[model samples]
Structure formats: C-alpha cells, structure tokens
Target: MSVEAIVNDVKTRADVVVTRGQEALEVGVKTLKTANGIVVEGVQELVQTNVSAGKELSTLVQASVTKAKTDGLKAVASNPVAYLPEGKATVLGAYSESLKIVSKTGDELAKTLKSGVETISAKIQGQAPVVAKARKTATKTVAKAKKATKKAASA
Candidate 1:
C-alpha cells in the first residue's frame, strides 16, 4: 500500500482505540455510580432497622417499668416485704425480653449488609465482560498499528 493509505489506516485504527477507551471509561463511571447508590440504599435500610429496634425496646421498657410501679404500689398498700421476690422476677423477665429484641436487631442488620454486598458484587460482575472486551480490542488495535508501521518502514 502507498504511504498515504498506510497513514490513513493507522489513523483509523488509533481512532477505534480511542473510542473503545472512552467506552471503557464510561462503563467504569457508571459502575461507580451504581455502587454508590447501593451503598446509600444499604445505609438507609440500616438506619431504619435501628430506629425500629430502638422504638420497640423503648416501648417494652416503659411498659415493664409502669407495670412494676403499679404492682409495687399495690404491695405497699398490703405488705411491702412480700413485693421483693416478685420485683426481682419482673426485672429478670424484662432483661430476657430485652436480649431477644437485641438479637432480632442483630439479625436484621446482618441481612441488610448481606443484601448490599450481593447487589454490589452482581453489578461489578456484570460490567467485567464489557471492560475486558474493550481492553482486548484496544490491545489488538495497538498490535495492528505496530505491524502496519513495520511494513511501511520496510516498504
């Protein structure tokens, strides 16, 4: 081929490489944005779960305290000494119920985290093939350019 034709071919190849590079860059940016959205969603879910748990715990404690107070008052009207064992049992029951609430909260948090991780991983994995294909195309374009240059020089 003439020098002019060779130069044109090389230029076309370079353009293809640049276009592919841009496509790869765009895909990376999109992936990053998607990941950021997932993180935000995850955080929101965690906050909501924690708030719900807090409300439940607070309500339970309040109810338990109110009951204990009422019972104590009744005992005082009768015999205060008889109230001690019942008070201890009530406190222990409250503690046990509180532990159950905390355990449920922990479970909810773990599920949220797991869901976030799975979503992020799926997004990244989905983009992998597109990025790899772009890289491969870029590499092939470079190799072709090199070969064309060598042929032109020898000509």
Candidate 2:
C-alpha cells in the first residue's frame, strides 16, 4: 500500500475512536446526573420524615412529664404519711411509661429507615441498564483506540 493510503487509514481510525469516546462520555455524564438526582431526592424525604418524628416524640415527652407531676401531687395530698413511697412509685411509673414511649419511637424510626433504604435500592437498580450501556461504550472505545494505535504504528 502507498504511504499516503496508510496515513489516510490511520487518520480515519483516529476519527472514529474520538467520536466513539465523545459519545461514551456524554452517556456517562447523563447517567451520573440522573443517579445523583435520585439519591438527593431520597435523602431529602428521609430527613423530612425524621424531623416530623422528632417533633412528635418531643410533644409526647412533654405531656408525659406534665401528667406525672400532677398525679404525684395528688397522691401526696391524699396521704401525707405515705408520701415518700407514693412519690417513688409515681416516679417509677412515669419512667416506665417514658421507656415505652421511647421504644415505640425507636421502632417507628427503624421502619422509616428500612422503607427509605428499599426505595433508594429500587431506584438505583432501575439505573443499572443505563450504566451498563455507558460502560460498554467506553470499553469499546478503548479497544478501538488500542487497535488503531497498533495498526498506525505498524504502518
């Protein structure tokens, strides 16, 4: 083959590699942006749920404290001689109720977390095919570039 013909062949191969590389990069960027948006949306929803749950827990605690104080005062007024033991019992009962509230709150938080994780997992899984396509394009671009380089050097 003429030297000019070899040179032309090399230039054509280089152009094809460049075009394929650019296409792959565009696909990758688009995929990344979509994935990032999905993750941000998921995180925002999780945070909102947590904030509301925290507020509810705070309200419940405040109510529990108020009731415990009122009940303890009533017990002391009814029987002054047994005030110490009655006060202790009242305090213990309040603590037990508080513990139950805390346990329930914890369970709710766990459920929220589990649901959030599953939703995010499903969304990410949906993007798998797009990601794979981008990866395949990149791999093919690299292989073409390598083959072109080898041929150009030999020529």
Please provide, for model 1 over 1-155, each residue's C-alpha lDDT reduced to its tens digit, 9 standing for 90 to 100. 89999999999988866765665566555445444443444344444445545666666667666656888776556875543333444455555655654554454444434444444444444433423443344334334534644554455
Could you tell me the lDDT of residue 2 within candidate 2?
100
Off by over 4 Å in 1: 1-10, 73-155
TM-score of each: 0.41, 0.47
- Could you give candidate 2's per-residue lDDT for residues 48-117 as a string of tens digits? 4455455566666676566557779777578655433224444455456556544544443344334334
lDDT of 2 at 3: 100
RMSD of each: 20.8, 20.3
Candidate 2 local Cα displacement, residue 18, angstroms = 0.7
Compared with the true structure, model 2 gives a TM-score of 0.47
Residue 122 shift from truth in candidate 1, angstroms:
17
Angstrom error of the Cα, residue 84, model 1: value is 14
